[model samples]
Target: MPVVTYTLWRLSLFAVTLVVLVWVGMGSWLAIVLAAVIAWALSYVLLGRQRDAAALHLAQRAKPGRSAPADAEVEDAALDAAERERGAA
Candidate 1:
């Protein structure tokens, strides 16, 4: 499954669990905490494949260039210009 789809699936599962718990008389905080724990556990057990696939996909799609130093190219250009001026003189 895609990362977005997998994320939505997890969120929906948590919401459903929380709603059920709340309807059954659990307080909001307790329901939210329980739902989070339950969802975390279930996702580990039941959605392992999907989670792994999403992680792999994300890793594969990540680009090192996307995080390169912003000033690297400009600095290289300035250094080259200075070198050329020094050599000419």
Candidate 2:
């Protein structure tokens, strides 16, 4: 949720800047490029809290043994069993 919120905020900033630049008669490509750069800078400066939250969420999610899928657990068990059988033979 935090990641989603941060993404939405960045995209909104980009869109608004793009619209303004286009309205001022900037070329489409230039407006898009400028808007992206401006949005990145603004988000970096203004969205520190949100960015931190999103980063923390991602870090937690990527930790080992953190709610892995059931199929993955089953596959691990099967691999262990196969290794045990080979060792016994």
Candidate 3:
């Protein structure tokens, strides 16, 4: 999985855990801390593949002179393609 996806999954897990703990009469502060710890432990134990993929992606992107393209450039290219298709039609 991509880094963004993995991050979102982890965040979602934390949020859900926090909500459940709070719903069950736990103090908000305590719930928050427990949620964080539980989510991290769960992720560490169960999400090795995703974590590894995300770490590798981050490492590659962090390398000097190596980075993903900007979103604007991707959007421009997509728009150009659409325009060409319209012209052809």
Candidate 4:
């Protein structure tokens, strides 16, 4: 859930920044661009912990030797059975 939390936080920051910029008489396009940059900068500085947690979570999920999904396991079993049958025949 760290990834989800981090994503929500970033999106919330961007939305608030956009609203504030638009309220200050900035054009919509300019406000969007500036808000995105501002939000990214602010999050990078202020949300370091959350960013690290999210990164760690992603890294763990992508690490080698993780368990295969059930579908993959089942597929492997089927392939093994087919190969054994072919060998026996």
Ranking of all predicted structures according to lDDT, beginning with the best and ending with the worst: 4, 2, 3, 1
Residue-level lDDT tens digits of model 1 in 1-89 = 48988899899889999989999999989899999999898888888888988998888667555666447787898999999999999
Q: Candidates 1 and 3: which is better by lDDT? A: 3
lDDT (Cα atoms) of all candidates against the true structure? 0.87, 0.93, 0.89, 0.94
Candidate 4 lDDT tens digits, 1-89: 99999999999999999999999999999999999999999999999999999999999988655865666678899999999999999
* Among all candidates shown, the one with the greatest lDDT: 4
Tell me each candidate's TM-score.
Answer: 0.70, 0.79, 0.67, 0.76
TM-score of 1: 0.70
Using TM-score as the measure, the top candidate is 2
- Backbone clash tally (model 1): 0
| Between candidates 1 and 2, the lDDT winner | 2
Better of 3 and 4 by lDDT: 4
Residue 46 error for model 3, in Å? 1.5
Give the TM-score (vs. native) of candidate 3: 0.67
- Tell me each candidate's RMSD, in Å, in order: 4.7, 3.6, 8.2, 3.3
Q: By TM-score, how accurate is candidate 2? A: 0.79
Query: What local lDDT does model 4 show for residue 43?
Result: 100
lDDT of 3 by residue, 1-89 (tens): 49988999899889988999999999979999999999999888878998999999888887654566777788899999999999999
Give the per-residue lDDT digits (tens) of candidate 2, residues 1-89: 99999999999999998999999999999999999999999999999999999999999998767787667788999999999999999
Q: Cα RMSD for candidate 2?
A: 3.6
* Model 2 misplacement above 4 A: 69-78, 81-89
In terms of lDDT, the poorest run of 10 residues in model 4 is 63-72
